[model samples]
Target: MTDIDAPEADVKRAGDEGLDARLVVDRGPFRLDVSLTAAPGDVVALLGPNGAGKTTALRALAGLVPLTDGHLRLDGASLERTAPESRPVGVVFQDYLLFPHLSALDNVAFGPRCQGASRAEARERAAAWLDRMGLADHAHAKPRRLSGGQAQRVALARALATRPRLLLLDEPLAALDARTRLEVRAQLRRHLAEFEAVAVLVTHDPLDAMVLADRLVVVEHGRVVQEGAPSDIARHPRTDYIAQLVGLNLYRGQADGHTVRLDAGPSITTTEDLSGPVFVAFPPAAVTLFRDRPTGASARNLWRCEVEGLETHGDQIRAVLTGELPLAADLTTVAAAELDLHPGAAVWATVKATQTHAYPA
Candidate 1:
């Protein structure tokens, strides 16, 4: 289930005919270096922060950006130097990039037409694809007349009609409204799951990645920071970027008995008994903040912190604090007023030992 770099012979012997590439692209001060390998029927999602080279990696795979080094292989063939149009790759851009002048039907048929299909055959194939996307009624409608979701499906049908061996999507749902995104996302998931070839999507939304991808490849600063099943990554994040993405306060420390002495400065008591290096994680909701230290509190894990900032997170107010420990705590709107939580308010933070989960790093 892993797609990290493996020996070439081992991969070939397993009958893996999918995407095998080590892309290295340099642009001025930024350089993208990412290695990817996935077999057929695999939907891999690339997740990262802005300027993390997620788009650059996708462009390199599509041949839009030439690689400075490394190889690009798909189904036992090397496409390292192949032109974008010559490669067996299909790209669904962030904006859907549909043709303004052509109707939905003609736009879809354009891919097959470029691949040398006859006009009649292309239209026949396009019609069937639109029907499959549940957009048969809108086949003759121009891009201006169709909705955002309709345009996205048309773009997908067009990309899939060419029979691509490797499909790449750059921010597939970023352009849609919230409600439309949810609907289109479910449709896209079904299509990608049905796709028999390798499909890779780049997205910033954690929900989109978790719901759509069979596996996630988390990139940070032009490198693969973590790659695994979405559940596995969510349970045990290896970096701060991922911890924030999955909504957890993560800290690495040395563990002995039930105590974890954080490398950053403080110690956290947890229910798990472990030894050596370990990661201690707890949710923001587990933290309780007060104006002063409580004398009869049941929580053994306590820290003195100052409120650095505050923001509304969902239905609660999430306050950022820094002092004895830097962490985020979620409190009710009324409780925040009671504590007088402001930019410089001093507060005592406490968490029950059972709320913390410790695992070997």
Candidate 2:
């Protein structure tokens, strides 16, 4: 069976779990097309750069964007042509978009009320959802009265109160401050873990996607470039974008035993035993820079490089170097000032063989 079938089989055994979609959406000037599937209780993240159509795919599944072709199946039923309100789908937009004038309880009750529940029944269900989301105290508060994190939770409760079979979140944590994001992300992860339905979230933050989703579908130019578990994708990135996203320096090479001959003009000695086309990856922090090429160092990879640029990130300075091999080196401000490092400075970069990891391409 294909990778797609493997997950579907797991979902069938899990009972009312998962969604399968083959979506094709065409705008006047752009077309987005992709196939995706996730098992019940699975949180799949759609990750990509700006204009990569991550949002478009989410919108298509939510019935907000019409599909030019393809199918959407939840559990076992076809929902390709279903209307947004008619489908068993729940959506939490980037801004949360809660009704500022309504109490949190009423906002959560909106969906069930629209679904034909009695006012009393809807309010009861909404109260239960608010309690579950840890917002019981805030139920009577207006959206404007809640903090960013609290507002996010209310939006989540509103979506869950509808009892959707599939939940869609568009940049769920994008609007929060850094501190709020951390707290909300942890809360969201807990909720997603407890959710029995299939949940798909669209995000540009790698950390958010990695921590929140069981698997990731990476898109570029409106097509899927890679899709797999977060750990797998992080270890074996297939494209430069994925490499950069995960903060690794990747190079294609030909390997024999412990030595890999890189196409970019260097030979790296690694501990991995691999053959044929391979990839070598290391972090910028693993690289050590010297004012002059060393003779007695045990490092297997060493190259003379000219500093191209230097920039500060947090407490560390990242030095961009170009030579036989282009590399990024992270150094302390004290070390940088001591070395008098600046753009156009010539330096030697060295890395131990054990610091480099090689895998089949």
Candidate 3:
């Protein structure tokens, strides 16, 4: 059995038609340079912070924004200058962009009708799509009459009605409330799974990307910082932003055998036998704080740090510690109260050598 958390990259099927593109779009001070590839039945997610050029790259792929340089291809055909409507592509915008006056059926049927389908044929196809989306009973309802999830599904149906070979979704679940997002995300995952073409989705939510996509391409400042299975990236983040995003305290250092001398000041011991520059990372939960220095602790990694700040993180207290090595540490609320952890408090922190993971930088 495969690990449920493994990334899609680890198991991508070979020899299937998919997308191949190296997009470079420049506008004033902003420039997006990213390369992406996907296989048939693959769902690739472009994940990054806001203004990280994720949507810009998607728009370039959809032909809404022309590329300044590089190429766009799908299934071995070039589409550098293809018009948005002419390309074998479909897009679901951030806001759904459903036609307010059109019933759900007409909204989904519009795509087919525009492609020269007869009214009856288009309606038949649209009805089937609505049925697949569990919205057959709402075929006659207008956009306002439907809930957020329903409207989103309608948008998806409309996009798929065109039978696109490549689909693009820009922040597909950004508009939904938290609870609605969870429900719709599961639904979207099912729909994407059934899609036979290459699908690319833009999202900043790590959980969304991890749950819905087979592979994740992390972009930052208009360039791809990392690309891999979500599980691999989570276990070994290359950049500070990625480490922080994955909730790990990451540091750069030089390693010799089982120990790493951090560039920041302190050193860390790990189980890996590595040499040369490397990165050492550990979860905040692995950290233990002491109000006073311990007389004898078995852990070789210890540092005296001053509490810079404290905040609540999902029922635990996250203490921001600054010293030779600045890092975040998580403690249960009960433990925090017992230690009276507060800003400006001095404490000793320790982590076992077994807890720290080191990888090549």
Instruction: Give every collision pair in model 1.
Output: none
Task: For model 2, name the residue pairs that clash.
Answer: 18-40
TM-scores for every candidate against the unseen true structure? 0.94, 0.93, 0.94
Which lDDT value does model 3 have at 182? 97
Please, what are the lDDT tens digits per residue for candidate 1 over residues 269-338?
A: 9999999999999999999998988899999999999999999999999999999989999999999988
lDDT of each: 0.91, 0.89, 0.91
lDDT of the structure predicted as candidate 3? 0.91
Could you tell which candidate, 2 or 3, scores higher by TM-score? 3
lDDT of 1 at 213: 96
lDDT of 2 by residue, 1-361 (tens): 1111121122324456478888898887888888899877789999999999999999999988888998889988888878899998899999999998999999999998999999998898888888877889989999989999999999988888777788999999999999999999999998888777789999999999999999999999889999999999999987889998998888998999999998878898898988888999998999999998888999988999999999996789999999988988899999999878999999999989899999988
Which residue runs of candidate 3 sit more than 4 Å off their true CA positions? 1-16
**Per-residue lDDT tens digits of candidate 3, residues 54-167?**
999999999989999999989888999788889989899999999999999999999989999999989998888898889999999999999999999999999988888889
Taking all chains together, the TM-score of candidate 2 against the true structure is 0.93
